[model samples]
Target chain A: MPEQPVPRTGASGVIHDLGYRPYDGPRNGSGTIASALFLSGFRNAFGLGRSGKSKVLPFLLLALNLLPAVIIVGAMTLFNANELPLGYARYASATQILVSIFVAAQAPVLFSRDLRHGSIALYLARPLSSAAYAVARWAALLAATLVFLLVPIVALYVGAVLAELDFSEQTEEAAKAALLAVLLALMLTGISGLIASVSVRRGFAVVATIAVLLLGNGVVTAVQGISDEQGELRVGEVAGLFSPYSLYRGGTSALTDELFLTPPTGAVMTAAYFAVMVLVGIAGLAGIVLRYRRIAGR
Target chain B: MEQVIRTRGLTKDYGSVLALDDLSLDIGPGITGLVGANGAGKSTLIKVLLGLVPPSSGEATVLGLDVIRDAAAIRARVGYLPEHDCLPPDVSASDFVVHLGMMSGLPRVAARERAAEVLRHVGLAEERYRPMGGYSTGMKQRAKLAQALAHDPRLVLLDEPTNGLDPAARDDMLGLVQRVGQDFGFSVLVTSHLLGELERVSDNVVILDSGRLLRASQTRDFLDATGTLLVEVIGADAQTRMGHALAAAGVPVQARGGLLALDPAPELGLDVHDLIRDTAFDLGVGLVRIQADHRRIEDVFADA
Candidate 1:
């Protein structure tokens, strides 16, 4: 066998053989679709499915949210079989509030890690555009948050059906609760994910997410509480469009069988609020992605 | 004759700080060494080529695709090994590489196979299944290299691959890097601040200082000799006496190590062999070694 040549370390050998070539494999679909799907898979594989540390708190929050539903059923079955409690709806409302808080707190970790670690550089070097990167990250956050919000809500609905015992009535009530939970979860996840993407630091992202979730509601509540007018339309319906928590509260209230506060006068206003809030959240997320891309480039 | 990465007046700014100055460069394939001190914008240039960061000014193309317009296309074909420790602590090297490979468009089965092959190649097969958090610095660097190669990219951008490693580990990593570019035929752009080290492995060297190109040339040119003789011998007061002897004999000599370094003086028509042998015979000292001192590129830079 011929003796192999030793590898050259200096530039003389390298300059003549600048061996870079463009990839000639399957182009696929302009990269956006593939990148989005990959990001989704990455988030799913790692976020909810991988670690005990990541999953525990979210699951615990879900369990806490469902605690009231379990308590309500237990009280009706084991304690009071005749009439429902005076403030049964209020306990359900509290569940929505708790889920909102949990989602807001966790969303920052999803967006901040990629930026801090420079892994985002690796991803962008692929055929994925900044827009696609943003969408994928946002999708991951939404999906993870949805897992936290949906599981307990579904458990509560199933528990509610078993508690009712009357098959026909149970089916109708369970369907209604499921629909309400899905809508609430979507609103919460979208808003939290948007807030989280606004900054690269986890601390800032978390603070911004929580501010949108809690302060937005507080502002609306303060406006409603001080107003002396009768049938004054709660800003929670309109201003809630600015915050995920408010949107969830308003949507849940609308879906409930009992009318806790007078229903917003028009369904159109509620629909408009949801639509506007979602668009704003998405736009905010887009801004964040563009800013990050610029920063990373530098 | 293909340019893997070409840039024209590429610039990047961070607030008031210019991270990358107006840089015009042509990066061809194979293992091209990018050498610069810390804060010379090596990382910035790599990030821009990857299309992770948009330039403040100028244009660049990687793998024949416009860096800005065809970023995703470029990224899909390129692999990157970052300088810092960024692996997820909870995931095993095999799992992470496989996941990244799949994300780059390989099917699940293919990704797994590629991940196994890459991990084995990087000498991490025994520990591939272990979580990265427990890995030593060498192991972590190997794991990072494994992930970058897992997708079977056409080119790899390695940022200080030998960073945070012992001398033996650094040599091993450099050897692996050379193999990846030569044996596997993938183009590599590897960065380092240690010029001499890269001169041992890189075929081409691009030197940068303060975000400006100092020199870009073949490694041989940088290490070529300037025709100066270095003489070493064993005796009492070797360098000092030899220097005095050479000076008295009308030859210029400088004391270096255990040797008397002689500058090339054309006018004297000096015979280095005769002079050394005669000096050793007269002094009754054994001659050890006498050879020309090959000037390194860094030495040239220092002279400049």
Candidate 2:
């Protein structure tokens, strides 16, 4: 083997040739690749490993999201209320603008940047399939959204515990809220990730996601208000099915003490609400996979 | 000879375009240059070999693994550096390579070690920690090369490794590729449209034209000296004088870029080298040198 001298910097610097050693060690399979992608993608959503400037938006949104929860806890202690002021399930519903903005702003960080920069080609060239890449990215977004939704619930639970509220009641409500948060996170990740993946431009993706989420919610809220005024309970409930937030509200109202303006009342409507939620989530995930498969094929 | 890549009438067709048209090849282990112009199906062939694109018909195998049925297995053993930009701008080369090494099945710690080694091998050790967005074109290509080698595969397919580099950097990159094949014990199938760039590094050459196999041969065969001599002389008007004198003496003489081309006539049994020497001595000019003219890869393309 030829020894090429390494470039010298300082006089004290030492160099070694350590000739190339072939790696015959054991290698993990596609499962490991997908998991690594998931881990990296999860960190990226919160701007971890990214520039400090990039970290500001997601974290600022999180701080704002938690601000109301902290105040509710403080207010509960000061007023000596018999119970927590915000129901566990209703916390996300009331402060959903922050949640919507968080998912909208961060989804592109995980999805749009890779496709825009053509780095997804690197992942597809590995042992991992394009479907696995899409699924891993969606999983990362879902996990991040879950963290966003769960932090406030935990804070509220701590506050309620210290306030000496009924332990069993608070536990059940927190558990139910946790379950609903999972479902909500699934749907949010699916929708936002799909939008971000479809549009390669980051700014365009963020705006489109915000439009789909907030515009859809705004129109549904208007319909629910008019329908409630008209005393058409069926119209209001059906309009609630049109938006993800409304669906979550309908679920919490049906399953918790919090009341929504138009909750899915009957067994049939309630089942449809839950079914649609899961279906949209699944469909959005499937769309992202198909999109990536097309890119890989090209 | 054991083959590193083999294809039996492989073909790929997009309804409007046929990317690979009935190409059959046997590429043995070593450094082989896949040469073609932009639309000559080099990238398509690399994709098929890596199992990213399935063939419309026929068969191909890499490292003896079927391209269709055992695509994932083939991918595990073969590394690919795509022709286009494939790096994430925000991630450092170290992190990107380490992550890709893990993606190739190495555990985290092993991946890190391998990444460091490969980055240094590619001469990116000093700049490995900087974000790729701030990298020079040469640095970016080196980082890409580092990731491809991080997994230590048996074969590496490099698509235009020196695409945007200046001449000096291109020379360095080609030298590294030669080392990868000779010193590092990896079979390489590198592609380039520039004909002469691969001549110095490749053991064999394959030329493609409009999705068709144009030629494949040993690089030495393409560079073999033909039965002609290139004569150079010193002094003003010496070349014109030599051309006239040779032609007058019934030798087929031509001027090729300031060098006098002499096709000796064996029928007359004239010693052309001796004649040129005496002519130069008689003309009061100096004979610089007389050497055989060898064909270049560019000549092969021009002949086609």
Candidate 3:
């Protein structure tokens, strides 16, 4: 065999022998690669590894998402109301618009940039399988959105605690809020990630996501406004099952109505609400995974 | 005798447009340059090998692993530098490369170390921290190359790596590719549209035209020697005088503008080269240079 230019030290400085060395080291499997993508996608969502300009929108939106809870909690402190001024689950519903905007604006940063610039090739050309890549990215977006949604709930919980509210109920509400917020983030990231994956233009993806999310609210409200059954609107309640905010509220209302001043709704409505929420969340996530698999193949 | 990459009846179609047409190749280990014109399916071939795109109707293996059955396994071992611009502009080269390193299954410490090593190897020592958005085209290309090498792939597929560089940077990139193959001992399949650019670095050259294999041969073989010699002698009207003398001495000679072509029959055994030297010495025409007439890579197009 001809002498290869593998590195061998001489008496003097090393010669022009080797520019790169073959890695005999153990290659981490798909799990590590998937975790890496998860970390990268998570950082990208918050613009951590990106430029200062790219950092602006997500941070601003996060601050805005938490602002309402801060203010309401602060007001509760000022009022000296012994009972918790605002409920945990209600915070998600009340600030759903902020969460929606955050998901819409940031999902593009996480998903569309890779598709638009063709950087998906870089991610796919590794140990990570296409499904792993998709799932990791979805996990990142879900986690990021959860952070956006949960921080405010925590702030509200802390504020309510500081306001001298009963501790036991607050803990339960906080736990419920955490669970429902996670569920809500999963649903939003699923739909938004799917949309952003396909839309090559970042602007178009942002608009499309906002439109889809906000349109849910508009459609749910309009359906509620138009359909009145005798004295109550079962159609409105059923339509509320379609919107994430309503589904979450409806599900949480089934377990406890501390967040809502009114009584818990019927068990039949609760079952349908919980069923549809979990179903759509799961189906949407599967669709997103399959979408990325197809995209990676392309 | 082990083929680094082998494909049989490989075909790919993007909907109605066919990118590869029954292409088959068995490339050995070395710097093999994939040369073709625009839309000649060079990029598609790399994509197929890397399993980025599946073959519509064929079979292929890279590093001896089946393309379809072991795509993830193949990708884990092969690095890809895509043809078009694919770098994320906002991320700094260091951070981007480190992240890509981890994606290739390197531990965080290993990834960071590899990122720095590759960035330095690609000549981006200090400026690797700057955002790629602020980088020039050449810088972006270097950064892209760094990421491809960051994982220490056994083989790297570089598609049009010097696409937008000026002459100097192009030469630099070609030199780096040569080093990667020779010094690093990694198999390289670097693609380019310009046939001439691969002449120096490529041990083997594969030329594709219109989605079909036009030529596949060793670079040295591709440059077929005409069994002729380019003879140039000093002094005015020297080529004419030498040609006449060579012909009179029973040698077949042709004047090539200012030079003389000495293509002699081997069966003659007349020692024509020595005879010409002696004759030139006698005439005092001063043989300036005598070299084998080699085929230029551009000559391939003339066949088409």
The prediction achieving the highest lDDT against the true structure is 2
How much of the real interface does each model capture, measured as fnat?
0.34, 0.72, 0.77
Candidate 3's DockQ is 0.57
Global Cα RMSD, each model: 6.9, 3.9, 4.8
How far does residue A255 in candidate 2 sit from its true spot (Å)?
A: 0.6
Ranking by DockQ: 2, 3, 1
Best prediction by TM-score? 2
- Residue-level lDDT tens digits of model 1 in A78-196: 76354344223334456655665676666665666666655665555556566666767666655655565555545544555555655565565556655555455556656666656
Sorted by TM-score (best first), the order is: 2, 3, 1
- For model 2, residues B1-304, the per-residue Cα lDDT tens digits are 8899999999999889999999999999999999999999999999999888999999999999999898888888888898899888888999999988998889999999999999989999667998999999999999999989999999999999999999999999999999999999999999999989999999999999988999999999999988899999875498888788878888898888878888757876878778888888887777889999888999997788
Off by over 4 Å in 3: A1-19, A228-232, A252-266, B13-18, B209-212, B231-288, B298-304
Q: Write the per-residue lDDT of candidate 1 for residues B149-207, one digit (tens) a residue.
A: 87788889999999989999999999999989897898999999888788888889998
Error of 3 at A197 (Å): 0.8
Backbone collisions counted per model: 24, 0, 0
Per residue, candidate 3 scores C-alpha lDDT tens digits across B43-99 of: 888878878788999999999999889988888888889877888777789998998
The candidate that achieves the highest DockQ relative to the unseen native structure: 2
**CAPRI rating of model 2:** medium
